[model samples]
Target: MKSPETFEHLVRAEFTPKSTFLNTATNALLPARTVTALQDAVRLRAEGRPLDPLYDDVEASRAAYARLAGVPVERVALGATVTLYTALIAASLRPGAEVLTVENDFASVVNPFHVRGDLKVRAVPLERLAESVGPDTDLVAVSAVQSADGRIADLPALREAAREHGARTYVDLSQAIGWLPVDADGFDYSVAIVYKWLLGPHGGAFLAVPEDFGDLVPVQAAWAAAEKPWDSAYGPVAELAHSARRFDTSPALFTYAGLRASLELVEEIGVDAVHAHDVALADRFRAGLAPLGHEPVPSPGSAIVSVPGLGRLQPELSRAGFALSDRAGHLRASFHLYNTPADVDRLLEALPG
Candidate 1:
């Protein structure tokens, strides 16, 4: 797992001559295999054939997601991004119910429901979130990993606490899914943007709606969600899909091809390996930064490491061919499977003391 030399060949990292990219929090580098898939998708689209769910790669993409999430195939649905899926989940909650989230969660996770007007939002600090949930809580919506500080949420504990309050859990896996081992079992609904950690095509995402959520209303409607999406009848009422797919958002027909390739590449590498590689990178980073006396965030073990004063160095470092995201008053250095210890070492050497 510590093969820093061979690991460097896995990504398009050298596309930039003198640059080191530590910014998966903003955008990820596409794997070589994924680029090939994109080319194939564009070529196939040029043949002037209409897209069909059966003929296209949608089903295959769905299957890949199901396998990764350990959920039944029918329980998965594709969305253009996590925003649309979160909106659907927010729309389905009982009217006027409370959605307990955190103030530091990324906007996409909180804004979708907060804008609803009908639901009351009680956003608190992450440390107190589990203690704050009570019987009045109807939904506990949060990111599996806090976007601001890179703190991994205690999923099993939170879900168990939410259960006591009869609250359904909706986890935004955008920051966790591909790089970490996430269990979709405890959460009633989980959503993720594949491009971030999955190294997939942009605008590709998935949502999981387990039957444990009971009856839910699809927030939006598309003919593609009908039981017979291909039926030319186009009747007044659509016989919606029995699975969570009834809530499916319209997909980018060509994008799924690349997405499937990306998913396969990640699976081939195995998430356990990805997580191991990611944590190792973080460990090295902490050790390197520790003696320098930079401030580390709450969880140094996570893939995303936040440090105070790192944000101020972004401009100077960018000129030196390194990249990271400045978010929530700190610079977030995120790692991916494609990243190697050499990448971390480069940043360690490059950063200003």
Candidate 2:
């Protein structure tokens, strides 16, 4: 782990936020290196130079994310959105199979299963998620961290319950990956969008699956999913990749180019360090909220502090240079690696009495 002074230095050198940005749950601000990488990718296209380098960016990001998620590179699939990966998982289920999910989970994690129309989808509160898994449950899908209020799902309990019930687990890490320690190997399938806590641009997402790729159908498989993409470009793919690469979509090249740098930065700072830093700031904000007559949602050990009945203040907060979110009438503020004590104090000071 990096020392606090070193972590602070690295964070300051990488990010130059223009606001008291507390909304990493909504989207992350790109680091300076990522911005440079994006600019370079655009310039490379403008010059019509050989596009070969961008492909390396894609693979590097995949490997980096695989490492972060504690999965083998061969088990990770690259894609543009979490929904696409969720749809692939959904398609693999037999008709009438039940998927148990948390109520009001991010749509990408739950809607794909529901859209299948044939699957029996059940919604339960986050607290009851693990205990609700039973013999009838074929799969358990939920976000590792709740997006609306940052209530963390008990993944270990969920995994144990799923295993005991002869069920599979699918975890959405979109809001948890960068700052939270997740063991992707414990779940049957897990997906994350890089633009949020990963601090990358839009257009990059990842799906991690078990060694057998969770028997996903790869319904959208194209030449990109082939064992030899260039050789298989024209015809039906001679052979799909034997690994999870077979689930990959044609990547957004420029996005991955920037994401590579951003992910590398996260690797350098370490997720544990980021988790400690972010949660501390969030705790600071939470502690001060009550003194101001505001109560935050009860989310212990989370880096997101959400206050119910304060959604109307979002516009006022934004105008005052506090960047956060209004989610279903809750004022949601998420702290991240780039956030500081001063940032949290400023938001608290600006809040109404």
Candidate 3:
């Protein structure tokens, strides 16, 4: 049987730029199966037949994603999370409604709040999010994990606070979903990218909106998102899918195929097992940091470890043939299924003691 690193090597070797290092930010790359699936999906599209089955695949992909995310299939919306969030924020808000957010939220999330008209913005401390969800705040939007610090927010508290104020909560689970366990049941709505942790292709994301908000329209719509099936007789109308399909931006065949493969891989290795492995890798990294006298920031101590190392680690790590990320006052290390104990050890050896 192939060892874990051997399996990773086989997958990585298939890609170019022979250095073959894994990116710590996204944790893993497209495996051979995903690449093949993408090629097949593209070839099928070239034939020019109606891809109603592709639509079914899209629905199935979200169902698989919802199961992995611990949410009901009815709650899942499939699309680019950023695009979906823009539509959701637009639909959910009245003119001049307040959106309470934190300082360190991801750019994709914060941008929608900033650009939207008829919306007032309120910034709050990352820790005091619950307290900031005041009566006037119509929506409490946050990244489940702060992109800057990699801090995991206390989601339940945020959900409770939003409910107390008659406000809705939108969670950006891009950085947290696969690495850690997220209870989508807690938030009124949530958005996440599939590429980062689900090991899926780019251009695919998942959104879980509450059942009651079924009437809420997505500002961005495609023919696939129409109320009726795609038939020649009916003209294009943005009636939207009654289910989470309302967020679809047409059928993305290649990406959906890649996403389906990744989802299958995730299922093969249970999410619970994946989370355990990731958390253990993170714990190992944190423990090693102490020996080098490098301290990790308090909040994102596990799964993703961020630290104020001696200098910008991106170039240094890159020069050393290691894949890692640096941003917002700290160097971030994300652990995924592909990472091994040896990789962690090598990372430690590369850092300044």
Model 1 lDDT at residue 186 = 70
- Model 1 over residues 109-217: C-alpha lDDT tens digits? 9898988889988998887788889989998888988777789888888988988888888898988888888888677888888778877778888888887445467
Clashing pairs in 3: 96-118
Query: Candidate 1 has which clashing residue pairs, if any?
Result: none
TM-score of each: 0.92, 0.99, 0.88
The list of candidate 3 runs beyond 4 A from truth reads 1-24, 46-53, 232-239, 309-311
Per-residue lDDT tens digits of candidate 3, residues 136-249? Answer: 988888888876556788888888888888888888888887667778887778888888877888888888887876336666666656666474125656366677766666
Off by over 4 Å in 2: none
TM-score-sorted candidate list, best first: 2, 1, 3
lDDT of 2 by residue, 58-84 (tens): 999999999999999999999999988
Estimate candidate 1's alpha-carbon lDDT, on a 0 to 1 scale.
0.79
Tell how far residue 247 is off in model 2, in angstroms.
0.3
Angstrom error of the Cα, residue 195, model 2: value is: 0.6
The lDDT leader among the candidates is 2
lDDT of each: 0.79, 0.93, 0.74
